[model samples]
Target: MSLAQPAPTPSRWLRAALPAMFILLGVIYATWASRLPAIRDLRVLDAATLGTILLGGGLGAVLSFPLAAWLLAHYGARRAALYAGLGLLFGLPLLGVLPNWWLLFAGVFVLGAASSCFDVAINAIGAEQEREAGRSIMSMLHAWFCVGTFSGALVGSAAAGLGLSPLWHFLLVAFVLLLMLICAYRILPCDAPDPDAGKKHFALPHGALIWLGLIAFLGAISEGSLTDWISLYLTDHLHASEAGAPLGYAAFAGAMLVARLVGDRLKDRFGARRLVAGSSLLAAVGLGVAIAAPSFGVAVIGFVLTGLGVAAVFPCLFSAAGREGPTALAGVATLGYSGSLMGPPLMGYAIHGYGYVFGMALLAVVSVFVAVAAMRARLLV
Candidate 1:
């Protein structure tokens, strides 16, 4: 049905279901993120302490990757997704109800593992669908994820404003997400592995997958930095009210939402090679703008630009990894995702030591690597 894809074929059910899974995953993540300020205030943690806690998440993700790949190999993407999705749901409530920071850290760590494993499952399914769909569908799929985040963020802000507890908010989100998962399960591939699929095993990154993984790593650092920091930055630096703190984050996700909606077309027009290079520089400029901005309002523009700039990178990189091979995809995804999960803690340490301005500027400095990688990465795919 698509103009550019080469494929033996993929199921219509899979093509239809994977995008919803992407959205559901985003909702799961954003809901927790939306309520972060509440948790911060409740826990009374400083930047350094919070960074330490967030590091648990990165560790969890690292632990989960091999397990996730094994699950995918033995049970297939569908079962892996459901298993991790449930794990994530179980942890969301713990984040709100934890008695202290140490327990919270443990809970977050578990959630982080669930998050990455879920991501791997859906992305593997997405890659399969993209190959079947021909042209570029990855961006559009991720766009749904953005949309879910945007909705969750807005809901979180409203919930905070309405005097709802984080515990209650998380429960409500979990219920909705659970329902979505129930629907998704009916349409996804069964637990049995596909013998003909040729990707039953996992391997370390090799050849082009290495370059693609590097590209994924670089871009993810920028993305993770923004997603984890923007809301807090709006509050601490700009003195925005708690209810309004999420606006900046919303702007960031909204820009990504719009960009990815259009990303497939852009990819078609420009190709991943040239497009990613320009996008990296654009993100750098955007970060610079946010860092130099005189007001919260102006900084939001920068966030929007930053979001728009990096929106296409994941879709392109992941799609290319899929093209390389399934084992390569798993390897590249783990490393690339490692970069994203690590960004928050790294930036947390930065902001703790220096200041918010310096922390943001650090992101700009990091983008330089992304720009260089983007240019060089074209040939690898």
Candidate 2:
């Protein structure tokens, strides 16, 4: 009789868990960056100039994405992620303390590049893990990002209350993220890219991926605008107290996290096409209400609706990309992230040119296009 071959060992659930940790950590770092407006004010930079500097981070990420994809293919997800995380860990604390505007720009650029690399590498690992586990888990994975963002807000509020310097606050976050990377190292997958996956040099997105990229871009613009500017909007337009301004973002993020935690179940039960279409319409209505409402309470409710509507869209897009092919996944994620890079600056320019209300109204119109694309693409399911 032939000896029985050992069954393949089931990978630990911790592999899935670690990526969430990184998402959370990255979000915390972003919250730290949001606190930088105050730092910029202290340093005497005008809004337009600060906006220009902010664009540098996006440029760096755009430049880095193709290179990052190649590195992930060659070096494996874990190693690439480790290097990226280390870069972010070092880059975060330096942003506030760098003294010179150019130095600060350089720091933000490195931060953007490193974070983009980490994002793609982690998503690649998550995709592989999803295959191995034989289940849909992408939505829950992203829910953790919302949770992380919420947690980061809390941390930022506390730090602000205590009057901690930006340098010290970011330094603390960096240290924690460093420890997280060390702990997460073992659980991540070590699978190398298929030797025959072909040498497809990184190029600009086109075709269906371009449409997908546009969807991502619109979604990112909406989300980034809310995250980057909502606090100021509430404080200035709605007469919200400084402490209360963050609550607007908290509402947005909290609703998003709750919706995303349940998103996979919703997708499985309701199907992707239905979920995306309905959510998009709901988001459009939410934005409309947000813009039209005279009361802050209504505006907050609108923000919550907006969050719920958007919660599942990005994860659905990511899942769609994964289904496309492993080789294409990096390009897809990069293109999607390019939206993140583009959204904020675009909003900034719009606000500078057309006032905050018009800028937000434009986003509302953009959400309608997202709904239309979801219906037309028919790829959601």
- Which is the leading candidate under TM-score? 1
lDDT of 2: 0.72
- What's the true lDDT of residue 311 in model 1? 90
Give the per-residue lDDT of model 1 (tens digit) for 1-381: 331222333566556677778888788767877777788998898888777787778889878888888888777888888889989888898899997878888998998899989998888888887888787888999999998888888988899999899999999989888888866766665545646354456666766567788888878888876777888888888888888988788888999999999988988898887778778778889988888889989999999999888898898888888787557777887777777778888888999999899998888877778778777775433
Model 1 stretches with alpha carbons more than 4 Å out: 1-16, 191-200, 378-381
Candidate 2's TM-score: 0.90
Per-candidate alpha-carbon RMSD to the true structure: 4.8, 4.7
- Candidate with best lDDT: 1
What overall lDDT, based on C-alpha atoms, would model 1 receive against the true structure? Answer: 0.82
lDDT of 2 by residue, 12-129 (tens): 6564455555564546544754475556656776555555666766777788888777777677777777788788788888876888777777777887788778887777777776
